[model samples]
Target chain A: MSAPDRFAPLPVTDTPQERGDAARNRALLLDAARRLIAERGAGAVSTDDIAAAAGVGKGTLFRRFGSRAGLMVVLLDENEKAHQQAFMFGPPPLGPGAPPLERLIAYGRARLAFVHDHHALLSDAGRDPQTRFTGPSALHHTHVRVLLQSAGTTGDLDAQTTALSALLDADYVEHRLAEGATLDELGDAWETVAVKLCGR
Target chain B: MSAPDRFAPLPVTDTPQERGDAARNRALLLDAARRLIAERGAGAVSTDDIAAAAGVGKGTLFRRFGSRAGLMVVLLDENEKAHQQAFMFGPPPLGPGAPPLERLIAYGRARLAFVHDHHALLSDAGRDPQTRFTGPSALHHTHVRVLLQSAGTTGDLDAQTTALSALLDADYVEHRLAEGATLDELGDAWETVAVKLCGR
Candidate 1:
């Protein structure tokens, strides 16, 4: 399937009012799920708990997302879209205004932070290799590839992006943390390599 | 435990006469295990099959390696040591006596090849986060760190190694390939990052 089809955020329409309601509903459900997940954890939080917390019917929860896993994916996709917007349009150096190398460096920090914040849901996605490799990852690869090109990298851009993206895998980050690596070290390491790739 | 203690290879004594028999037995069993795994895959090949193929008793297999998992550990350790020695003392490029940047690039290529050759066994290891993170990976990170330092990398050397090693993770490599990445692309990408880190 196409990248957007696989990972695009809840489709926005031309109309603002209907989109607002849909957006609000999504936020409500996600906020409730996030609260329950934080209180207990991903494994313990259930569909019933989230729906009840959101003051929405169980049927609406199921209709909005087919299952618990589906809900988690939608939540993660929301984060992914926000990240895309941050890098694509938000502000420098993470957005379009900065130099290529600096933008790439900022992008790494932003992506790593996103992975850290959404650790529970994203790590759950890591358990399945297909889900881990698809959708949002495609967008990430494209983003990195564009940055590499804009930065005047001479090597195979595809490979560079793949290596960079691999570092952002939540499973790898979690594994590194459990292995005693600090978040500071993780971001620092990314900057070292990313700057190098940007020919700085 | 220290990194060396956690990920170190099986030690062989300096006295050939004393170590020869033990080493021979270990090699003999491993040879049989490799053949059996190649023929029927790691999961299908039983301990009994390895023992029978090696012309040793089942009791001996159990005595040498405590369990199936232990046997797998020993097998991986053998490969890990070869990798360590290659980058530490073998010859130019992959070994000592080459430019730091060359050695680092060679090391990345060698590590990728090792992961590919031992794909099944290592992929199995990826299922357990502790085993996956603490064992051979510690050695890999150390190896990469030393290379980065020797090549004059100034940023977060620790994080740089972590990111580089994550790209070589068997599960991640497999996922990338399943998502349509070629080994050539993967290696080329490593060279890009390694060379850049080396300030080439």
Candidate 2:
């Protein structure tokens, strides 16, 4: 397909084969990109490399994701969704089954682990301030708000939400880790904050 | 003196007249810069404008501050020192002699108020990430670390310090203000975090 035609097929009541072909191509591209990221890390993977690996033209890569940053965002979105699921429904201490205080602590620990696991992806997403503030992972805001509500905070919801923003400040995280703080310690302190702020 | 030569006088054994002149010039430049900042926020003020206002050549301004961002840092330092003092010695809840928990709460309230009062200064200093991170006013880190220690946290001091860093994250503060959070709410939350972390 031509560069322009890639986006042209959207929402079309078209032949099933074309749609199937497009879906297969997308999967191929995504799988190849994932392999590259796993092998060499996000910074090492280039769009040309992804295209070459997937056997698609450079135009196809551009058409799929507007830029390298956009691709990173996609990869991060998948990671975020999985993390969100783990917290929302997958297991104890992090999911719905644990006590509120424990859950809060568990949440922080899990989040730190996830951040460490996907350090490059998260950091890349954060480079663009606009994206960090407004991207769909804005689920971050929602997640904390819900947790605070669960913990019995009766204060202003907006303030609670803003406080959550601070929890994600990268410099603070970097400084803490650099200062020799461990994941367990951070998790415990967050649990303390969460318990105090939300009560019981 | 030329900009380079201006700094060359820093190591003098004794140059009373030069010292006096330098002092007077510094005062004049700072006064003029403050007036300009008050009349038109920090963004509107420039090195050239400050020099014109102070009736000094541009070289003098550059020589004195090193850069426009440095000038903002100095301006911010004055207010930062005063706020630091209040928490160190001012009054009940925020200053010396209060119960540690109450004092911690007061510190947050005081900081929130400080941010409100010096919103322009904070905004200006934040423009340069380097200044924001390394500026002299980062004494908040020290202050917070001391408070956490006094409050009886028994964990690794390094971890406690990291927790303190999270408490002072700038994004957290700005997010609170942007959400129209009241000074009381910020103070209350800070107190809550302090108490929880301190085991009070």
Question: For every model shown, what is its TM-score relative to the native structure?
Answer: 0.65, 0.61
* Complex DockQ, candidate 2: 0.14
lDDT of 2 by residue, A1-200 (tens): 67887777454212455566666666777889899989998768888899899998888766666566566777777777778888888789788888765676687778877776777666666654346556645777677777777777765554554544454445455556777877777666666556656755
Candidate 1 has which clashing residue pairs, if any?
A189-B159, A189-B160
Runs of candidate 1 exceeding 4 Å displacement: A1-36, A43-72, A171-189, B1-75, B171-186
lDDT of 1 by residue, A44-102 (tens): 78889998999888877776665666678767786688778889899899988898888
lDDT of 1 by residue, B125-162 (tens): 56554455556666777778898898897776755676
Error of 1 at B159 (Å): 1.9
Residue B183 CA displacement from its true place in model 2, Å = 2.1
